[model samples]
Target: MRLIATTWQPVWHETPLGWLDRYRAALAEVAADRDTLVVFPEYAALEAAFYGTVTLDARGWMQRGANHFDAYCDGIRALSKDTGATILGGSGFARKGDQIVNRALFCAPEGEAWLEKQMPTPYERALDMAPGEAMPILATRFGKIAAVICYDSEFPPIARRFAEAGAELLLVPSCTDTEQGASRVEIGCRARALEGQMIVAMAPLVGEVPGCEVIDVNLGQARIFCPPDGTSPEDGTLAQGPRNAPGFAILNTLSESLAQARKGTDVSVFAHWPESETPQNPPETRNFR
Candidate 1:
């Protein structure tokens, strides 16, 4: 399967229709000749809050995003139908009862699902955004997949469940306003790929939203990583895009290759993880101390 990830440069729009058109144009860039899945960055739907000339702070824009979330996703679902390719529509804030949650929407001609971030950053928590209690697995023609939203990618257990569920890839959609933040998420993505022995792709929101405090200055790149084994890239980087650029980083992989990787050229970290968890007495180390 051909996997495409983007470092999407956010643009301000005077109208929601203009934003939808912009999205369509972005998808047009792929020119896919075979089965493909395109991933956008986290908070990709936050641009929907830019539907007007007025500026809003993190809280205000998030609330606005919550309001327009469903409608904005409907627009993306239309694009999926039009293009016939599965898309991970980054993420957006949505009001679920009294709490607001950050969620990534996965849609294709066949089906659609919403995956939530089980971990919300401190900045997000300060704005009253709630952490999701569950992480749902997404299924597509490609295979079972997990969309690990932004900071949630930093956690091990979250990605492991998907890997255990037979997920071939973990799609990370992120947004970071600083170099430090960007590096952290990128490192997390690589670590997840190595530990899971599965392909992991990351796409982040780039560019600036001049008046929007939440996304004023963005930094990120599109990267695809795999286990550093003989079956895959030895250094774990399969593909990487120009930093903070508006473009796609593409990688192609087959199920057989992934199966072989898990079976082992040097080692099978994916299969051997269970042995690490078996209960045993702690090794004596008092003499070293």
Candidate 2:
């Protein structure tokens, strides 16, 4: 399957329609093929509010009004139908009764959608976002795919669990500011791919949000990770954004190329670790000398 990952600079705290126009235009440029999977950066839908916050508290920043949030979901549904593309709809503050959750939605062309991301980060906890209960791996025509949002990538066990559950591809959508944040996420993606013998794709928000101090410098780097054997040309990178602006990256073929790498016996690094029989003791005679 072809894949497109986007690094978008969202207008802080704007309406969903405003975000759609910008995102749709970017999508139009990258969505040349219908059989493409697109991943948008987390919180790009609420760029305005994210940037508008003088103090960054997760739950406190999101507007509780139902109309605004519902409109955002409505826009995602429309985009999936209109683009004929599968989307890893970036993270959003989803209201589920008395509390809100930091949720990511995965929407396919058939109008089927699944929600994931069971835990939130420390910052997210400050916002009082509720944690989810289950980790689901969706089986698609392309392959067995899993979804993870920002911060979730930091935990190796989370990625491992997905791989163990038969996920061959992992999709991550993130909203982060510092170079360290970007680098850490990138490293994790590569590590996960190497260990699981799977493909890992990350889409991060590029540029700054107005009010948030955490995003003083825009980090717009996004990438695709593949196995070390270099089985897929699409493995390296489909597209990349500018260091300081919004852009989209497209990989024309991902699934088939990844499968080719998985066919080899020596492809996985985790299989090659040296076994330890016992701890070696220091030589007493040598110490006396």
Candidate 3:
């Protein structure tokens, strides 16, 4: 399967129609050859708040995003239908009652589904955003997939459940203010791919949006990771893009070498995963003499 991770920057002045055009152009860039899977960065929907006249704080921005939720999703749906590409439309704020929740929408030609971030950053919590309750593995024609929104990618349990559910691909959409923050998420992506023995791709929000306080001075890099064993890249990095650049990291995930590495490799981490759970011998405590 071909995968493309799109590093994006939110435009503070774009209207709903402008957003539609931007998404259409981005998806078209990757889907030129065939039906490709594209992942966008988190909080791309925050740009919707820019339509308002007032300067919004974090919570106010999230509320504005909630107001335009449907239009945000509809743009992705139309793009998916038009380009015949499967897209993870980054994470957005959705109002589920009086509380706001951060959610990621996955759109395909057949239909659309969504996943929420179980864990939110301190900044998000301060904005009154609620964490999600469910972790679902999305099923698609190419492969079973899952998404971990920004900070959630740092938790192994979240990614493990999806890996256990037979998901072959994990998409991570992140938005960080500093390069250090982006590096933390990058480490999480690589760690999860190594442990799960699956493909892990990340798309992060890059560049700054003038007058947008929440997204000002954004920093991130697009990257794809595979197992570091003999089956894939020794360093586990399949592709990486220049930091804070708005572009795509396009690569082929389905390789004969990777398939062979999974089945028979120098060391099969996927095959030996159960060993970590079941110990050969139980620990015995010895009293000090």
Say which candidate scores most in lDDT: 1
Off by over 4 Å in 3: 32-34, 253-261, 278-289
lDDT of 1 by residue, 1-289 (tens): 7888998977877777787888888778776533878988988887766766776777888888888888889888888888887888868889888999998788878777787888999999898898875546666667667778889888888888888888877889999999999999999998898888887889998997787788788999999888888756668888888898788888776454456446655877888899888858766667765
Lowest summed lDDT across 10 adjacent residues in model 1 is found at 253-262
| Model 1 segments more than 4 A misplaced | 32-34, 133-135, 254-257, 283-289
- Higher-scoring candidate on lDDT, 1 or 3: 1
- Give a tens-digit lDDT track for model 2, residues 1-289: 6877787776653443566776677778875335888887776555423322256443345653222555666677778888887877766666778877666667777555545456687766766667764447788876888877767787877887787778888888877667788888887787787777777888888775555443345575677777667544444453455555676666666766567546653544544422222337644654555
> Please, what are the lDDT tens digits per residue for candidate 3 over residues 217-279?
889989988888774677878887777989888777544423643554567676678789899
10 residues in a row with least lDDT, candidate 3: 255-264
Better of 1 and 2 by TM-score: 1
Can you list the residue pairs that collide in candidate 3?
none
